[model samples]
Target: MGSVLKLYIQVAFAVKIVSCSITMVDNTTSKSPIDLSTAFLLRVDQSGQGDYKRIQEAIDAVPSNNSELFFIWIKPGIYREKVVVPVDKPFITLSGTEASDTVITWNDSGDIFESPTLTILATDFIARYLTIQNTHGNTGKAVALRVSGDKAAFYGCRITSYQDTLLDDAGRHYYSNCYIEGAVDFIFGNAASLYERCHLHSMAEESGAMMAQKRESPLENTAFIFLGGKITGVGSTFLGRAWGAYSRVVFALTYMSGVVKPEGWNDWGDSSKQRSVYYGEYKCSGPGANRSKRVTWSRSLTKDEAAPFLTKGMIGGRGWLRPSPTHFKKYQTS
Candidate 1:
């Protein structure tokens, strides 16, 4: 009878393991099936303890247009280099244990498109628990991170710079539990993105704007939606300013400190844009969330109006947001 019980327990354990593997490898969250067993893992450690000493070296090893996933585990250290993931390399995950320990920093100011510290041009990329920053202090157009790829997601990351910090350029992106800091037009972009439970800190001394959305036309499906986050900063600032004719941005269920300006939205010195842009806020609390002095062009969204921005569905997250890999195999040099 004792042997019979032991055999039953062993069978149960085997079933549990199998079920967990199925969930990971079967791409349950994605519409398309991803055989995570094929995923490759690379490591970067400055202490001479990994596949490559530098992060870009490991990224260069990935084959162009490869279908397999590559997981680059970055060790705790500060990496000072300019990194770019070309469009050909997709399904790559840059993982670090903690954002405070593993950092990638560069100091470059000017040409926002050409001089970003890190540029992600690949699709289906993920960054987890890493700090990406540009220390071009109060300089002109210094972009810490520029993401132009489609279906990219950043989790537990810290992205910082001065002006034009994060260029959410062109794509459908998701930022969850991240800290973003900057002064003027820091979170500007034309991407259809969802910032969930993130912290946005403004470093402006006098006055600046948190976002400068650049949606050119009403027909374009691009907007910035912030959900369940907190906005705290040093000085007064506007929630957003219209950077395009039909710029759009929204904040819902967020806590805004007194740092936010009474007049929520700016028309970018273009009175013509007041009629085309779509800025809205819903169920937001705190002193800054008060819309008594908000621009007439902006909206205080109702429950029904805010429903669309409330879920991951706005960015089709369920179809592509694979938060974790099934497994990892150590890097092998060929």
Candidate 2:
């Protein structure tokens, strides 16, 4: 009898320990307002004992509303798959082993229907040192990365597609130290985006590349501002065409290649857009950057007028900006 009682006590103790551990884990993961710095690091290769080997699996494991920072450390490899970061998943950071070592790629075109390599609709997301690509070149509106998230940032990354490669669909996003390559409306969308210190490469094309389509609420004040960037194309390429009547874009201090046309804007088969579109350039240089006979509708913005659009407060707003290092570290391992 004494032995039996001792065995029962042991079983009860084990169950208690397991229950307590599960509760702790649940508390840690379910908390709202997650801190990204503390999130677990996921490695695609066998480098770490993460929850999963594939990027999509790791993303799936994260709770839809996890309020903790989650980091996916991707290994060096080319992952060809359609990845989507849905709206409910926030505070996710995807880091690569190295910019050149890790590549996430897929092939899909708008003509193909309902195919996108990566569709991002979550807020407060960051991707660094990786390449997101769509292999469908000249296939028609193939998107490499579609970002519709607020306060989303991509650094030291490469985004490649053909027609609509880098789709800044919605929100105030930032792309720095990155490379975006495409053909037609390559970098097009309705987002208030800031591309800084990046390269915009236009493939060989007859009509050239169209940069943006700002179709948003008139009061939303959406703008695409390129700072300290370069625009290069093979054939005759117009800087952009007006996709919506109130489409707004400003190219400041950019290096334009000779392939760009002087007019700097396309009609997109809509003459009414000519009246409502606002395309402007400031301090642009290069054979293609010539604005000598630019459309009368487009004007060059003064430095002062461009200041608000460049700042983080205006682009990202208040709540979307990631926490500072001090605050971020405190939240991690809490």
Candidate 3:
């Protein structure tokens, strides 16, 4: 009888696993972007099994203004701490064993300028195969990650929070195959950024807000391009809202879930922005692609109009960015 019960339990567990896998692959549930067990120069493990027990310790050890690639490998575990990559520590790479297991988290929510859990101010920096989370659930303006450095990239990482999950504050940046979760203005910034082959998951918030880009004017070299991604959430979602007069955001060849609202873009209660913001789309699909209901201010770009944004050159990355080594096939990573 015991053997029979054990067999039944095993079968039920296997069925549960199968159901979860199907849901994740169908994009109904958020999945780890990818698994990359890459080598690195430094290591962090809380079990005292690596070069250091703290991520910040490993980073603080890196030479200032270092020209070479200083890789720091963090093993599987939850690291509850705020981490900052200072301006002098250039060419730093913070990697993990895998995205689903390695976590760097903190619980703090305050003003946008002071609440980031992870701040990257160093140039030529890359973070991959891990998670950065602000654990202050439903708290005000908690930032999981913020990057204000030039030539930065994120690959196969997860930035999780409720509001303001990622502050792509300012830089020439790239995000490939990462999982980002938030409810309001989660992917907001004033940067030249390209998000390729990534996954955006929204929390179970009633008010759906995503992508609040701040670009003051047309000549400002900052814009956001999201390409070949999936947008999934529990509640209604807006593609973006103009945080500045000329906020620029484009979605190209992405799949959006039904949770996205038909209106597409918001003006933050200002009617004047409707005439100035540059919100455009090209070849986006799924339930959210109902362009007829989109705001008249939003645009459906022509093939020629989208050609510039479809390339990495849109962020002036050809001179510095390199291969992503993971999900993206054609474009460079960082």
TM-score of each: 0.90, 0.83, 0.84
What is the C-alpha lDDT profile of model 1 across 1-334, one tens digit per residue?
6743543343224222232221123322223335654456677889887779999998998878867788787888999999999999999988877899889999999998987988999999999889999998995899999999999999999999989999999989999999999999999889999999999999998889999999999789899999999999998899999999999898999999999999988998999999999999999999999999988899999999999989988789998887465444444544
lDDT of 3 by residue, 1-334 (tens): 6743543343224222221111002222323332222112455779996668999998887756554455576778999999999999987778775788889999889977578889999888888788999989885889999999999988889999998999999989999899999998999999999999999998845667789999998899899899899999897879999999999999999999888889999999999999999999999999988898999999999999988889999777787675422211111112
- Greater lDDT among 1 and 2 belongs to 1
Supply candidate 3's per-residue lDDT for 37.
22
RMSD of each: 6.8, 9.7, 11.5
Model 1 ranges with Cα > 4 A deviation: 1-33
Winner by lDDT: 1
The TM-score of predicted model 1 comes to 0.90
State the weakest 10-residue window (summed lDDT) of model 2: 14-23
The alpha-carbon deviation from the true structure for residue 275 of candidate 2, after best TM-score superposition, in angstroms, is: 1.8
Of the candidates numbered 2 and 3, which has the greater TM-score value?
3
| Alpha-carbon runs more than 4 Å astray in model 3 | 1-40, 323-334
lDDT, model 2: 0.72
| Ten residues in sequence with the least summed lDDT for candidate 3 | 325-334
The CA lDDT of each predicted structure is: 0.86, 0.72, 0.80
